[model samples]
Target: MEKKSIQNTLLMGFIEDIKLRYKTGNIVEKFIFINIGVFIASLLFKVIFGLYKTNGDFIFNWFALEHNFSTLITKPWSIISYGFLHAGFIHILFNMIALYYIGNLFIQYFTQKQLVQFYVLGTFFGGLLFMLSNSYFPLFEGTRPHLVGASAGISAIFIGLTTYMPNYQLQIRFIGFVKLWHLAAIWIGLDVIGLVGSNAGGHFSHLGGALFGFLYVNQAANTKLNIWDKLSGIFTSRKKPLHTVYKSSKKTAPKSKNTDLTQQQIDGILDKISKSGYDSLTKSEKEFLFKQGKK
Candidate 1:
């Protein structure tokens, strides 16, 4: 009975550790969860309302500006909120997948705060472009369309990360290794090509998001806070000192003992290295493993 109890306790502990790791894994995971949650909610709503259209009409009809052009003048928030609501499962899935790859690369170097800023700003600009294109373009003059999906935000992250690390490379299944900039070029090229065909609104929004992403990286490198940072500061208190140090009379103790990675964490890292190459390890992992090797 005692042995069984010990085994059960160990299993429970392992499960709890996994839960924590997943919860705090990385920015990519968080973005995926948010997108999935929103997709599910939209799906439920659509089912309840019996709205099953897919030609981007439903998005414009309900959440976006329909024939009632007067309503848009009063409710401008629709432009932003519309992006979160998707047309179907496949739509959300593809955008979320793109977001995961792009966002992971972004948060690898940037702080979570910066990641959120880029995403929101990109989405705003993307929506703005969509609105402007619809309003001004002679072809789309009569049609007021609605834009949806995380594509704009995802595109921004992609562009931002590629700009920051232009030479970064990834291994493709068919192509062994390819530079990040080339990949970004291909992505943008597709959007440009798509512009000449159907889904012009989505393509135009992609351009807007891409522009914001490019400008953001350049501005950030020069030490200028982008609009998102300034906007966030409005709600947060500014009186607090930017940096603080805590002091105690007792000798400051080394944190190494308490900070050592657990056996499970070490195993997980090793497993990842086995599946992917050692290069797959992020900077933090490489440092941790290097320290462990020395010890």
Candidate 2:
């Protein structure tokens, strides 16, 4: 009875620890936890099916993105759902690793909501391209393949970050420091070369996600053409301005002087980070950027 009680206590403690981590973790950590949880659940289902000598893959059948347009119409949720599913341990392992690193870096610059948008939209675009390629391309003719994995969403985040900070340097253990865009180019090149391979559909989906990431970053880089602002304007109520009242120069002078940081200063700091990496910033610059990120 004592041994059983101890085991129960340990299990409860472990579960509570996980809950605590999930609650306080950043967006990247939360995503990694979710992918791991989903993967474990999928493995459990597979084992149960195997135990019963059942050949049916109920989970993948319903959640994985189908190649056929008709099947997709019936199971629209699969478009985004497929990104959360994985075919094997090795598949999810590498994907989650990539997502963890890239996503953490992404979150340092962008908001959590923007990361979610990139992931979901990237997955949607990837699934769409997968189905379209299967439908129109001669290469995919007479073959039906379902897509699964978080690679598409990860690719979106990866490519999007690369587009924003192309010169950013990432130190690889054995490879030294490599430019972000260099890695992104190689990533896309590999997918392009994989089009004729067995996992052609997967490659197509990756490219689709990368394309969205690239386009999104490019569009967002232009502040005047921000899509988010335009979309928000549609839902936001506007009212005509009242007559402007001039403030005394004497009162405004001290207020302007009190503002230590300006938009131009922030822009210059961002440009420095882009060219020389975040570590290039001095203590004060880093602190400023960190404080700005919090706001």
Candidate 3:
């Protein structure tokens, strides 16, 4: 009996470890969990409601029309929540597969915070565009359109990763290594085609998210203010002081020949450069000036 108890405990521990791995692996795993959990919940809802259709309107039916509308207006959380809700098993399966692959690529280089920022921002903007298109466009007029799935967010991730690492290469099973930009071009081209054709709203949403992703990576290359970092700073600012304290002692120690120069000293060197050409300095001084400029 003791042996059996030990075996059971070990089994429980293994299961817990597996759970933690999936929970904490990356943004991809979290996305998969959301999709799978929603799918299971959707199945349960179907069982209870006796509804056979997987139409987007099911959100309205299962939840309520008012609740759905409220989600659009008062609570914008639905932008993300609706991504998890799917019309069928295949709908989520493809999305999760794409997300897993693209999300893995993103997380390899970017922080988890960046992944969250891109995903949430992409989903929000995508939903906004979809709603706008459905509301105003003649193609979708007179019909209450409901969208569910992670394609828009996934598309954003794919576009963002490609933009950040345009020269990066990937190898497919049958195809040889292909440049990342090539893949991004093809994906965006398909969305553009879809924008003017059928499923216009869905395609438009994908474009909105994709555009954000592209702009995000481009701006990130030049600045430190990624959407996620800005969002975090807002919340973190509540408890933090307006300015950080840098403790400096008043007493000055003797400077050694190898000691690093102060900013003022560096500025003086630059000022001398502005007056006299590079040839005016000694070899060691020239080397020191070059090193400072590099910094």
- Per-candidate local distance difference test: 0.67, 0.81, 0.66
Model 3 earns a TM-score of: 0.66
Candidate 1: list runs displaced more than 4 Å. 1-25, 51-73, 221-295
Which parts of model 2 have CA positions greater than 4 angstroms off?
221-264, 288-295
lDDT of 2 by residue, 1-295 (tens): 9999999999999999999999999888888898889888888888899999995477888899999889988999999999999999899989988998999888766667778878888898899999999998999878879999998999988998897789988899999999999999999999999999999999999999998887666544223323344433422344221110111112234535335445557668877877777678899987776676455
Summarize candidate 3's per-residue lDDT along 254-279 as a digit string, tens digits: 76654445545654554453334234
Give the per-residue Cα lDDT of candidate 2 at 192: 99
Reference-based TM-score of each model: 0.65, 0.84, 0.66
55 in model 1: Cα distance from truth in Å? 17
**Given candidate 1, what's the lDDT at residue 184?**
93
Model 1 scores worst on lDDT over the 10 consecutive residues at 240-249
Q: Residue 286, candidate 1: how far off, in angstroms?
A: 6.0
**Which 10-residue span in candidate 2 carries the lowest summed lDDT?**
240-249
Q: What ordering of candidates by TM-score runs from best to worst?
A: 2, 3, 1
lDDT for residue 16 in candidate 3, whole number 0-100:
94
